[model samples]
Target: MTALPQERRVVTAIPGPKSQELQARRTAAVASGVGSVLPVFTTRAGGGIIEDVDGNRLIDFGSGIAVTSVGSSAEAVVRRASAQLQDFTHTCFMVTPYEGYVEVCELLAELTPGDHAKKSALFNSGAEAVENAVKIARAYTKRQAVVVFDHGYHGRTNLTMGMTAKNMPYKNGFGPFAPEIYRVPVAYGYRWPTGPDNAGAEASAQAIDMINKQVGAENVAAIIIEPVLGEGGFIEPAKGFLPAIAQFAKDNGIVFVADEIQSGFCRTGQWFASEDEGIVPDLITTAKGIAGGLPLAAVTGRAEIMDAPHSGGLGGTYGGNPVACAAALGAIETMKELDLNAKAKRIEEVMKARLSSMQEKFDIIGDIRGRGAMIAIELVQSGTKDPNPAATAALAKACHAEGVLVLTCGTYGNVLRFLPPLVIGEDLLTEGLDILEQAFAGV
Candidate 1:
């Protein structure tokens, strides 16, 4: 294999011939439920570019939906992962543990918010970590009810599906979901009915009231939230909202879980988005950027709470696989070596400025939000707050055709999220933003 160059070069159409052929095979053999944001299949990825099968090098803005935060193939990550692969791959952590797994857990304990005694359990995906967090919370508190916010996305598993707020693709017809899960209003300032200033106090008070009246605090096992809402369009909770909620949970003995699946690692300019507001959660669920591109996730929390589960209750056949643990270590190495938190902050400054300028120029670009490299723009009707999913789709399509990959998200499907790799070059990122501006102009 050759080294992937850090440049966007389009030698063929967006999908080209090879990708289209592969798409046909995928359609016939793969599940219809699995969806693709952009149909371009990649052969190699590094820095800010995804090289597809047809020899088209597209600037990546999605970072595989925030999975490849250190870039698709950071040198440190590849080196460590390759060494681990050469040694050995598996041996369930439960039956036989490895230093790599333990080391990753130690890193999580040190990196996650709160300096108090902490412990961690590993899993394969964010959903597993989240589900385990709830289970641990329930076991520790002896409670039955779980609380989540509107427009938040936890995962796709049966229990997480119940916890997730979206209905169409994530929850539609997937019902018979786990019981005792409750939904409450989130402090989404942009769309707050009473206006942004009142969103913080009002949403928190209403949510607390609902929990008290509808599901008593004694019955609540946990209150889970994304410090910066991920699939919910990167809507950071309004000021005073998260602290208020966290304090309420602490007062009532409810475990406060920060689902940092998409906002963790250096994706949000901080180790975790919870740090942005100085709110320390009782439990934190992390994945995505944790292990570069490998499948690894964890639930780290107060040692007492994490240890509540039975001895044999938490282990899984593949939880904390050695190779993935190695990859996570390497990813952390890259983060520290490059100061990706600072890089993410720089990206946030760059992107927010660019997107804010675009917002000034485009009436459809309603709001610019999110922190660090996880920024997004919500599309709305010309001069109103009404969501415009059609324009969102059109803009994304236009960018994809021009060899710049982007992603669309949110409950109304009106958000264009930009999760460029933290290691992306200033030139490539600026060029991608340029393409995005042109796409908006075309739209």
Candidate 2:
């Protein structure tokens, strides 16, 4: 087997000559509304190193926001996808079905958390998957109200915008959001109203009580949540939170939807984050790393619930494009063949050790949390848990200047999440952590 790249070899300052030229071109050609990190333009990426247009090599830690878990250009993914492209690209599964699409659905039904004879529908983005999941739930339960948690991020679509909690980029100026979308407190341990110990289950129960009293469980269609909150900070719900909510949904006849878009495909040390809690959701939305960087998303749920929407209810023109299906199959194969779940666990072990050490040394690191490779360090003011967004931003910039790409997320933008590809090597991983430590020290 070919080994992954190691070490950061900075040939020129980041955004080197070629990158500078490309950046100028990008400014003119691309939309200013789009945002990017690490101005360096990538020419090639394999395993952990992203070779930029200037031929400068940098260690990757973001994994394209956890979308390339098997690596940016895994041999398996490339080979399979290329062959499929040669054959054909799109023949929308809705208009003209294809075997590849059915194969992907079969794989999803078998691998998704539940084993209740599930069915699946595909979409092009996470937001679409979430929207369709909600539609399916409402159709199945015959209810209008859908509940979402604070600090949860669903997507950028109209309905998902209301489901999403963040306001700045995702929801700002994009109102009036869809109605019947309710927001409740999440089981955020660090900023919990109650302490972290038993607060998770308590918060969940309390939220359910509010829904019952306010929205009325009978009128609620689904409770959509990220098993591990993604853009709202990589906050993993308290131990009992997911199970408690799922049980409440089951008892109240409300659908339970797990949004695993950012935490699926072995990113959280499991095939799906919901698997960690051992709770089976009625519907699950997935994207991000599902197709190894291809734009593919899916909603998998109990057969009856998925079939609730009338014959022509759930579909899109580009939904389940053959090329994306092929890529997804390849991505799944790569994950299984390389044992990426175990690789994620291994990355977690390294992260816990390094971040724990950093925590002892740097008061700025308020909390370190996440499962497997989906880890994060929340920055805070010295001697207090107050979010320190400025410090986080400075640290990220410092890392980027040093040819180590990192990403910042959290409601306050005070959290640095490390979502390196599972295939990253120990040497590069340690080097990236070293740069982070230096950045913290410099700050």
Please write out the lDDT profile of model 2 over residues 396-438, one tens digit for every residue. 9999889898999999999999999998998889989999999
Worst 10 residues of 1 by lDDT: 1-10
- Record all residue pairs in model 1 with backbone atoms less than 3 Å apart, i.e. clashing: none
Clashing pairs in 2: none
What are the lDDT scores of the predictions, listed in order? Answer: 0.94, 0.91
Give the candidate number with the greatest lDDT.
Answer: 1
lDDT of 1 at 404: 91
Backbone collision tally, model 1: 0
Q: Candidate 1 — which residues are off by over 4 angstroms?
A: none
- Prediction 2 global C-alpha lDDT: 0.91
